[model samples]
Target: MTFAVNPNASLFLLPDPVTCFRSASYNQIQTFHLTADASAVILDWVTSGRRSLGEEWVFSRYYSVNEVFVDGKRIAKDAMLLDDSQIDAKPLPERALAERLRPYSCYATLFLVGPQVQAVIAELVRRYQAISVMKMKSPDKVIWSLSPITGNDYTSVIVRVAGEETEDVKGWLGEGLEPLRQCIGKDVYRQAFR
Candidate 1:
């Protein structure tokens, strides 16, 4: 839940709210539904928070950008992570996610929540066929329900973190995520989607 989607990785700009909210259209943010291939995460923008803007993967490993003048240096890679403080900063929406070198495509998942997650998921699978299937199940002990964001296209479901839980699994595999796994494992998420 606590993933550094933010370039700066700070709560100041992208605050980690305790609850997930949504827009009337059921899309509040652009989520990347990524599937982990052995050592890397391959993804296409799931739902562009800005529905009208469209999605484009900033593929650097797959493309070259020598034109974005970088003081005359050939831009091998272009990320706004110029400083550690900016780790969670949101790259201006103009800059889509850039591809990097990775030996394997790691596993991942994605989905939306708040009030519209369910409606969005249903529509994606039913109408677009983008999501073949999905089911809601309880994942947490105290939480009311865990409506996992499932789809054939996703390897990792990016759930919005609620405060310290982000720190719980901030490392990508820890208590927070472990508990989530208990709620929806590979087989479970797959079966439900299938």
Candidate 2:
């Protein structure tokens, strides 16, 4: 899917999670074009198939691409490809895609750009910088990272998260993006989380 945000306009994109069924392959590409003064919030996420049926990452492959452009110049492009059939385990135990992404059943990526989201970006940066990573005996329930996109005047940020449960990630994202309620309106923001 493609989107174009006009100058001085704001856009919010929060789509449903993509679920790949057994032996299925899924591919998605999303592009966003925005003027220098435009602002946008985008969310992309995927699940480990139908967990209740024990179909965790049983799909053959999954691919996704997200690109953002500002003022006709590309600022950020993120791509991910996961294929279980491409690996060749010779003489050793075969490793599945699930093994590579073990301890996490859900993954999400969010993009915040333009002047409207500067406050949210600043808050995320503050919270992310305050975190102290320490050695843990077991993996944590959820993990996330925040990075700023260069060449955007510090107005763009990308956030990636992985969680053991989908709901956990959703809750975390909802809380983290609470500041956007003022920009996108409480009703519109609530719909995204719900």
Candidate 3:
């Protein structure tokens, strides 16, 4: 069965400036990224426009608990503006870093986040659609393993099972294990360490 979005949630691009789940406004989102490089002072937001199981769905079960910026505020605890003054001068202001997003599955919604690294992912998927890739699974977490060209460290592809799709927890075993293998096909990039 295909993954489905709940009726209440609505997906929006970055700069939407709306609160998540404040109204009939809750939904599934795949690959949601709100990255702020303070050095750049510019925010980079990426949403795959897919709630679940499109490009971001490598595995069948997705469950996650991580900080997600909502409403352009850097949230530390319970939407408190506790550290607003201290983080204002930083390029991407810590304000945009702390806003937390929690998906209430009792509401049947599993809000996914990622694509903080997208170009890397799109290229790998394009190159290895038919080949089997290597994967390392830890519980519901599957990480895409990529070896750096210069040496032996690996860049990871994160795979998760959102809470709403509880039925497919068992199907994620085989998952997209091949992308990891095909992506490392002797063409791995040696990223200049920052």
TM-scores, all candidates, are 0.17, 0.93, 0.18
* Cα lDDT, all candidates: 0.24, 0.90, 0.25
lDDT of 2 by residue, 52-168 (tens): 888999999899999999999999999988898745666777887898899999999999998899989999888988999999999889899988887545569899999999988
- Candidate 3 per-residue lDDT, tens place, 37-137, comes to 21000111212113443432211222222233323432211111211123455465453212321221111111122223334444444544554655645
Error of 1 at 175 (Å): 4.5
Off by over 4 Å in 1: 1-15, 18-28, 31-142, 151-175, 178-194
Residue 20 error, candidate 3, Å: 35
Best-matching candidate per TM-score: 2
By lDDT, who's the top model here? 2
lDDT of 1 by residue, 1-194 (tens): 21222221111111221121122111122212111211111111111122134322221222111111112322122222111121344564332232221111121222332221233334433433332344557322111112333344422123322211222223322332232333345674333222
lDDT of predicted model 1: 0.24
- The predicted structure with the larger lDDT, 1 or 2, is 2
> Which consecutive 10 residues in model 2 have the weakest lDDT in total?
85-94
